[model samples]
Target: MTAGGDVGGHPVGPDVAEAAVPRPGPVRRFLLRRPGLVDAAVVTVFTGWALLLGLGADSMYWLHEVLGGPRVLLMQVTSAVLTLAGAVALVWRRRRPVLVAAVMTVLGVLSLALTGATNGFELGVALALYVVATTAPPRTLLAAAGASVLALLVGARVLPLARTVGAKSLGVDPDDADAFAAVTGSGPFGFATSPAWFAMAAPVVVLALLAVGLGTLVHARRQRVAALAEAARARAEEHAQRTRLAQASERAQIAREMHDVVAHSISVMVALGGGASAAFDWAPDRARAALDELVDTGRAALGDMRRILGVLHDDDGDGPAGDAPLEPQPGSLDLPRLVGRARTAGLAVRTSGLAVTGLDALDPALQLAVYRIVQESLTNTLRHAPVATDVEVDVRRRADAVEVVVTDRGGTAPATAGPGSRRGLVGMTERAAAFGGTVEAGPYGQGWRVRALLPWNEGDA
Candidate 1:
């Protein structure tokens, strides 16, 4: 199927949905979202605190009665309105944290001024402080913290404490001061009578500030580390994808060269051998010798081709024989056989400069490279040189490299060019390059010559 088209013969639709469905109202939709649920829970906790402190506390009884009277019912109504507004501020705490924090801070200061101290009101202040520290940037948070500290100090000085000490001095029963002291420590209006009230309150405020700063630093550090790890993983995956693409391209090039080298040469050898066998009675010894050489040459080519095919197939699975040793190819040791094969193919083959005596032994890969170069050159001569041409095969070992030359003398006219004439030269060059070697091939002195120089101890394949 074509890309972006369905298998059922239809074009693919847009990736994103086109139609918009009508959603419920803001409150209903918010209740459905996850953050909305958390906001609802926070508001509920604040409401419970307001109820317990504003209505249920005995200390608030006189205040409630005075406010709840019909003559001044607006005071109680105002208190209820302020309490609800503080709780509602939490709904937008995460989405608009700075705005919510400012609203909560203003409401908290007003509530303390009007009622002295309420139950759930301190929670709003604490939540505002947390939002300022965690959600805002460092500079903004620091500014907010400084403003909050100033507000707290102003509240401590301006808001009057309930008359607990006067009740004790007058014969009226006094309420315990521990609960009030817990929430509002020894400042100007605390239960304590010490002269260093500001000193004691200073440490508590500093501790709260330090706690918020540390929490913000830890959270920011974790987020940065997570971002770095995600970027590293993406880069690693991209590198792996590029590596696979390169390997696939290399495999395709190898397959094309193998098809040209193995298929063309072997097909010609098979046809020549068959013709020679059929004409054996007409020409006895020459035909028989040609047939024998053809058989040997075809077998050698088949073996080399099989080894190459095995390597290709092995890439898809474990391998044939599950790790059996690969069958080795012909090297300089089989040069005579290669020459005989050329002779059988109707070419006069000669050799010179093949001495390897008293020289350091060559690596197996280099030996195979020299052999393939000679083999391809002879195959090209048989396929391209004129009939009755004499071919020369030469090999010499240098200090660090082995030089090979294949030269042919044209007899009458040049032989007809076959398919992939240039490709054979490319394959020969690729083989030499695989072992850090170089090849030169062109027509010279009435015929063509191919030469290759391969490193004796180069480590590449």
Candidate 2:
């Protein structure tokens, strides 16, 4: 909303936000650049010729006398004035094209009837019809053009021939009998060899059709331009929508990483800290060892936390990751360290078949799923199974799957951190599910059990 051109909370560039209007095509740009000047120029073209032709028409005295009216300038001057007035309507042709065209047609008919001659207002009518054609729909354009042609033909051909015959029957003076003939002889409008109805009708129809044809062609080009503009806008909006979805998915991934790193590390440190404090009174040596273990646990947690956070600082891929320490993806190689951490936190863990062959042939994504499942299961045992003395971690590789099972003997333990949020379990299940795997977790006798199956193709394995 600022003068600097901001739209919908985004700072649009100066080149883009010029007036916040839709971009203009060639025809529209011309009219929009100087609308008043364009209107004035159109009015001048029509009005200038109309006024000139009005001045050259038969004298008012001759026209009224020959048409069997009074020998005054009443009808002649009136027709001239009406024709000039219709010419002024050309200025507004673009804004009210059909209305202006209808008005001009009516004025043309009146002028022909009053003096039995055109005052060059047909040119103005033709221009108005062109405007109407450019703006009106196909059906409307057809109707308006048809009506205009019929009215002009009646005014120029049928009405004049009838008026002349009436004037002759009324015994008009012989000297003024050729009024209609003289009017159509030659003037600003092209000359007609004969004043007969058919002679006049042909020109009237041709002019009207020509105007409509030009208008229709312009409208077709304008429509094509408008359609292309609409398509471009749709593509831009789609791309923006895709970018929003990508950002949302990335944020969710960051939340999962933070939870996994913080929960496991913090749980083990708290248990070590508690044990050290409890033994300081009676067993000084034991307390010292516990404190030392607590320190070591804190350092390891800090290192893991740093590794997890290093991903947030974008590296730009030039070389170093902003000088932040790099870390490898956790996998089967880290299983021994993981188990050691749980043992340090006072959990007795037993492993079987930890060195499964062909484990290295697994895809990184599948390996990641396996590692997170085991880590989350061990963290759950440490937090919820304090009374559990034996924790078993079993790894087995079959022809088409890698299976992991973690179980504790005594699942019942006094709660140290109230209730669980259950996000850990959800994260584990989600990771396994990403690679078409499944996890089943529930109670097994007095202890809890978590079993995971990550399927793999033989070619991939």
Q: Measured by TM-score, how close is model 1 to the native structure?
A: 0.65
Per-model TM-score versus the true fold? 0.65, 0.78
Q: Rate the local accuracy (lDDT) of all candidates.
A: 0.62, 0.72
Tens digits of per-residue lDDT, candidate 1, 100-197, equal 76776676566556654434555665566676676677888777666665665465445653233222222333344654344334655453542223
Which ten residues in a row are the worst by lDDT in model 1? Answer: 12-21
Candidate 2 off by > 4 Å:
1-30, 57-80, 117-120, 161-199, 281-313, 316-321, 458-461
Candidate 1 runs further than 4 Å off: 1-91, 113-137, 140-211, 231-235, 242-246, 249-253, 256-264, 267-281, 284-302, 312-325, 353-355, 358-361, 386-388, 409-411, 418-423, 457-461
Which predicted model would earn the best TM-score?
2
lDDT of 2 at 75: 62
Task: Give the C-alpha lDDT of model 2.
Answer: 0.72
List all candidate RMSDs to the true structure. 11.2, 7.3
> Any residue pairs clashing in model 2, and if so which?
none
